[model samples]
Target chain A: MTTPNPTAAILIIGDEILSGRTRDANMYHLAGELTRIGIDLKESRVVSDDREAIVEAVRALSAKYTHVFTSGGIGPTHDDITADCIAAAFDRSIGVRDDAKALLTAHYEGRGVEFNDARMRMARIPEGAELIDNPVSIAPGFSVENVHVMAGVPNIFAAMVAGLLPRITGGKPLLSQSYRINRPESTVAEPLGDLAKRYPDLSMGSYPFNRDGAFGTNIVIRGQDGAMVEAALMELATLFPAEEHS
Target chain B: MTTPNPTAAILIIGDEILSGRTRDANMYHLAGELTRIGIDLKESRVVSDDREAIVEAVRALSAKYTHVFTSGGIGPTHDDITADCIAAAFDRSIGVRDDAKALLTAHYEGRGVEFNDARMRMARIPEGAELIDNPVSIAPGFSVENVHVMAGVPNIFAAMVAGLLPRITGGKPLLSQSYRINRPESTVAEPLGDLAKRYPDLSMGSYPFNRDGAFGTNIVIRGQDGAMVEAALMELATLFPAEEHS
Candidate 1:
């Protein structure tokens, strides 16, 4: 495992995601998983199923981040061209692999479904790619070079990622602490601002919410150093005189 | 309104959005809205509140698309720094405009709340910026040089976009239709594959969902042409053998 901070970026593909028809649960789940593994999620981009756009985004993200995890657009449908776009981006030939075919055949056999041509298309893998296991669905997501491509359906995506993430290296796991402040963001900005200056490493964010017609805030403190996060929490505690101090 | 096709992009900026704590509802809402108005949503990107990232995304998107609507990071808190980022990107100085100050001042005064420095920070606009009306909260989201920066909160974002969308020129509105197939995607792939060959302008997609412990498929047809989308739908209907049709 490399010693330096490992950064990962997620490229979420699909017109559904961009259109808001699907409330993306994968990003949050992946974020928590990446955080636990000490990976800094430097960036996440949502792009439609347009092949050229997908190819361009994949190239930009894959080149910049240590690891690139793309969710969605890997199905058998026409819009499911993420695998093809990824292959094009990496200059890899798109073809069916024996291993992926075997996995899909076994999965379909277990379900008592026919291993037809459309179903077989899921077995198409970028040349020289390693399969990422999908426990929920038999057709697996795949990883090539540094890019991991997975399903768009939340559960399948989560399962595919769960199988893949443990195998990769991560950075210093960030420690996170949050407390709800039953006051407007204005009420806490100054002290929170001061605390940020004091804990330069910690990323302190104040999210204002409207609860029961009364304004409240959730102050989130995040950093690689647990002690610094706790110290920031202590500083935040002094700022608002909050009832619940975590 | 000279329009061959109106094109728009959305820039969602928030650590919360990137973290997945906040499922981005605005992207969907805005995408649907733009589509309804005949504006093709060519691209959508989500970046964190990092000034450089925001500036970079804005500059790039603003250059590519006709209109760029951004949501998030326009609030009283320091992390709400989208305004500053936009100002920096456009090489314009940030200043509290008299109009924004008056609106905030009036809203706060009406509510009997103190319009302090933090609250006043909401009034800061980039030079040469035109304010997007926020009817929900007095704090307005602004548009500077083809970039419309709105609030990240769904309600405010929706409200601002509603007020702003009608003013812009939209191209031909998108036409869409869908039908469910009782059979698996495997059964219909060959025919759908052949159909896709005939309709080059239309985008066709099939989503497989597990219902009653069996796989069911929903085929969606989308395109700028209304008659073409309906024609494709009819072709799909004939191919699928729908309950009503047969």
Candidate 2:
């Protein structure tokens, strides 16, 4: 059997998320991006901006997965302590690196903004970490070993992923196709279960919905093999023939 | 000193979310609700619908937090294995509990639908577990000790939460106030950090935004004490002095 694809975990460090002040946009974005790049996103965790919590999760996820991506807490505020936590997790010392400082220094100085201590905080990269280019913002995200520290802001996060994904060698891209049936999920579960048994290598998920008082289920079949996914979708489409509005 | 409020963690079990086919709605909904009820939402984790993963997460979160709310994988489909995992985690024998089976039976009977084996899967609850009522859907979620296993569907999960929250006693509701300053986050970080140090009990988070070619920062102050939060917000207002368009 072929070797299993590389696995990944996301560690979202933010008090804003845990406190419910902000709904997560970063996790969703990264999950989709990672899927597109063929990296299996195994687990995602949102933790408060507490040092112990951040360090523990960082170490655990880093050890468990092929890659551990972290978002939030890399900003220029006291609450932004992810860089320090990552350094501590790997037992390395953190400091304001000259290269990182130069990037921010140039960006701010060009805009006539002072590279103050607050802005300089963004330049605090862990020792022996490579900078991930940020096209949206000047403050760079860093990657130390297996952990990729990214900015939490949605656009910046997306930009960093764009720059990072191309550098990592990913496995086959997962292909998926979905079928919508105008029946309740309970009615379709048995057949779906049988189909799942037939295709043991593929994953089938049924999501139910109630829209305009009509009960319906959306069946999504996914696998690394595009032909298999297409065949399964074809079989599903034939079994649950499309209705007028389906 | 006040007794610490009960802490909670959200465990989202769904392969659909891990694959990025679906974004999480249940976690965000529960997070806000728990925040309002004075329950500290310590962490939120999303794991795949694998048995070992679910069981390990359930055992870990259940042990660490006062409550563990899990969403997804309790549906009628074959992929739905949350109830089984929870049972296995707690070493409880699981079968079709009569009370739960009867509810689904009657609901299906009333609607003139046959309650087949697929539908019967919903009634499988662990021994000696309290049923969490799902008003929207007749299939009941069960509470195995501290772990509350709910449906993956957003509406069903929410209905179960609405029924479940009333029974739990929460501490003082965490109160929060926010101020929008036209200055960028880097510019406001120093003062916001100072304010955070002054009010050790409160959490201060500065979220930066860019809209209409203008950059601004939204600073949120949170604490269990309402008056203290008010006092801090007032002080923040005085320090920043809200601008006309702010």
Candidate 3:
């Protein structure tokens, strides 16, 4: 019996990203990590630091997917409204939790930094939520319902995902193999489609690349079964002949 | 009397992006262009090339926003199902249009390449849709109702945006200025909030960065009015004092 893959959606909350002030690092990092761990990253949304948008997105994503991972807006500023928004989405009360506060306090004291009111806001988490660790910074992320909220900074977000993903159950890891053909995508699309039809369970993707004035296509075959993936890759290698590109 | 700003949402369609095989470049480029043209980019979504998901997102975003821009899935592959999904979204008939076919024919003929069936698939356009130009490659993108579908490749997407944006009416360009302060966000949050309240029309965003073991914040002030943006920047500079950072 095959267990279906657990699906995830990512909600990126920050005005900087939507306004083009910052190129997102967290979404790309999380997508790779989730894919590796057998959790299918189905969709990702980027919304500005608006309260209503955040709450609405959190509610919708948490309901539709097995997990909803959010990055950004959990900071020490007025615009950092994600924690409150998450609580509002789930209709739960939120305030500074003692455990979270103690963690931040100890870290701040160790670093000789003042744990001011704004910094203290980091400890504010929804009721009945478990804290996700932030090894880079002491401020903890939290998982409320199906939603996991993490810091926007790339390093901190990566650290949080490392701590969080192991606890969640995932299905068999999706396996992928690629073959590079020096021919254009148009030349490869027809035969590739036939190959795809023969193996209905696997997904085939053709990504075209132009490197140093030479056009080529990277065709990736992906599926949950390793033996099936290997079989498909072998067929693709025979059809495309890898030595042409090498 | 102030007219409301036109709002837009971007739908990025591809499995490579969701699977972390490719980092997205189109969303960033589109966001910056939309911001410059005074269209408020309210939301952006990245979805894998699943038919139902694509159709649902296209319908929802088109209904809610002033304009919806979609990138990706107009290629010569089996997984390139965006055109069909778009037709299903609007309940329109789609087939290879003569204009699109002509363009691709000329491009391939000029390059001494075959204009085969797979390449001809790029010419398919939904009924009552207008073609968006693709100077990078000859395949045309299309605009149906408020939805504009463009190529996903960065260069082609950028070129299409250049060709398409000028044709649409835009509001006053959103003006912005940034001041980098060599202080933690905790140190700057209180006064920044006060300053934000003083200029309610402008938006204040505090982006924190940690570089080389030192922490700092970049405060960005944005609004439609140049005068309001300038005023906010002046206050921020005086409050933070760039000389301190220097």
lDDT of 2 at B54: 91
lDDT of 3 by residue, B1-246 (tens): 235689999999999999998999998998899889889999999999999999999999999999999999999989899999999999999999999999999999999999999999999999999999988777999999999999888888999999999888888778999889999888898899899898878889999888886888999999988887898898888988877895
Model 1 regions more than 4 Å off: A1-4, A109-113, A243-246, B1-4, B243-246
Model 3 chain B lDDT-worst window of ten = B1-10
How accurate locally, in lDDT, is each candidate? Answer: 0.81, 0.89, 0.91
Looking at candidate 2 chain A, the ten consecutive residues that score lowest on lDDT are: A237-246
> What level of docking quality does candidate 3 show?
high
How many angstroms is residue B92 displaced in model 2 relative to the true structure, after the best TM-score fit? Answer: 0.7
Name the better of 1 and 3 by DockQ.
Answer: 3
lDDT of 2 by residue, A1-246 (tens): 234789999999887888777889888888888888788999999999899999999999999999998988888888889999999999999999999898888898888988899999988899999999987777899899999999998888888988998888787778889889899999999999999999988989899988877788999888888888999998888788876434
Query: Could you list the iRMS of every candidate?
Result: 2.1, 1.2, 0.8
Instruction: List the candidate numbers ranked by DockQ, top first.
Output: 3, 2, 1
* lDDT score for candidate 1 against the true structure: 0.81
For residues B103-128, write the lDDT of model 1, one tens digit per residue.
Answer: 99899899898899988899999998
Ranking of all predicted structures according to lDDT, beginning with the best and ending with the worst: 3, 2, 1
Cα error, residue A180 of model 1, in Å, equals 1.8
Q: Score residue A132 of candidate 2 by CA lDDT.
A: 96
